[model samples]
Target: MSTLVVRRAPITRVLRSELRMVLRRPRTLIGLGLLALVPVLMGIGIAIATANGEEGGAEGLAALVIGNGMLLPIFALSIAMAMLLPLTGAMLAADALAGESAHGTLRGMLMAPVGRGRLLAVKAFGVASVTLIAVLLMALTGIISGVLLLGGDGMLTASGTSLPFLDALGRVLITALYVTLQVWALAAVALAVSAFTEHPLIVVVVSLGLVIVSGVLAAIPALDWLDPVLVTTSWDAVSEVVRDPIEWGPLVEGGLRALCYLVIGGSIAYSRMLTRDG
Candidate 1:
């Protein structure tokens, strides 16, 4: 018998193929379109605030900061995680094994000179890249809209203090980074769920259900102690980035918790993908 040679594919080639697949899907395109509209929505919100006598300066900045600072970022982060992020992650990962199996291509692909582990790794990396891109796009749209509509003057902080325009911009950027990390944690959960199911809708529903349940659990007064334990609790950590005195405790703890979720979720996904029958 001839020896079977396993040739590793370039990561770039795999990523390119993944992107093409993602772009071709109408659902993915719809998600991207919605994310693009965030700026317009923010503009409308700002306009309404302005019409209510909130214009640029310390008062304008204060109003903008109070209105959007934590709240806007939280909304952006939640929407990205609850909807767009999961949609892309589930599309890629659910399709990874199930789509091929449905089309009777999995066996053929497996017979090729590629190890199962390598194939899985490529799929995981592709899904992750897509998730990050979606999150970054959302943040970009939100921040630009906020600055333009709210007027990039001084900023009124959560603690009733003011900062220079440049400083406010820096805070907004840092908040965006935190939002991105939170979305990454959500994407990891979707990927893990995707690895277990053959139905793409089921994967999406399950992941979303987890998010909703976490949110609910985090909100209950009796579960006050459990709030810190829930991954969803950390979703608002970006707000702390802009607060005076700059409380790093919540952000730091949140980051650590999010990292733990990513590790656990990724481990589960890898194990399921490797061992499950295609």
Candidate 2:
């Protein structure tokens, strides 16, 4: 009897393939379109609302329209991270494992000498890359629209203090990166859930449901103690950087949550795949 050995695909190849597969999908493009659309619509609506010398509402990120056009990216990112980003993340990640299974590619890939754990990690990374790109795109589009529609270079804090435009841009970049990190837990959860099922929709829906539940609970005064454990608590904390002597506590908390969820969820997904003989 004789046996032949085959080479496994390189991690880069796997990642590139995953990226192509994920990005080429109509759903992913649709999600990206929706994300980019939000800021444009927001900018136009705000422009109309404040047309003819009407006063801008000094409430939340909405007030950014009157402050600085660059600030609109931050506002757009805030909304995207809240629901749009996570939902898109869920869609991407939930499909990473189960979607392959749905398409009958999982078994073929496993037989390709690919390490199960590495495969899962690569898929997660690919999805993360898509999501990170989405965040950047949303921010860029928002900034461009804001610049053209709203038109300003000065910055304002929630408290109405003014800062140099350069300082504001730096904070916006920091906040965008920080928020990007915070939202990975949604992908992590979806990845974990994705391992056990062949049905991508179920994984997507359930992962999104869990995230929504966490967000809802975090809002209730009774669930205040659960903030540390919730995946979303630190997500919006990047806004803290907008303040002078920027607050570090919330960002730290959010970073820690993101780390914990990624490790725990990734571990479970890895273990589940490792055990499956398929």
* Most TM-score-accurate candidate: 2
Top candidate when judged by lDDT against the true structure: 2
TM per candidate comes to 0.80, 0.91
**Candidate 1 clashes between residue pairs 3 or more apart in a chain or in different chains:** none
Against the reference, the lDDT scores of all candidates come to 0.66, 0.81
lDDT of 2: 0.81
Looking at candidate 2, the ten consecutive residues that score lowest on lDDT are 56-65
RMSD to native, candidate 2: 2.4
After aligning candidate 1 to the native by TM-score, how far in Å is the CA of 250 from where it should be?
Answer: 0.9
Model 1, 1-278: lDDT tens digits are 49986667787897688667766778667867777676457656656866787665544223434345333443455545545554555565566655656676666766766766677667666666666666667666766666666554566676877777677667766766676666667667766776676666776677677777888888788889888667678876666765787899988888888888788878887787677666
Residue 134, model 2: Cα distance from true site in angstroms: 0.4
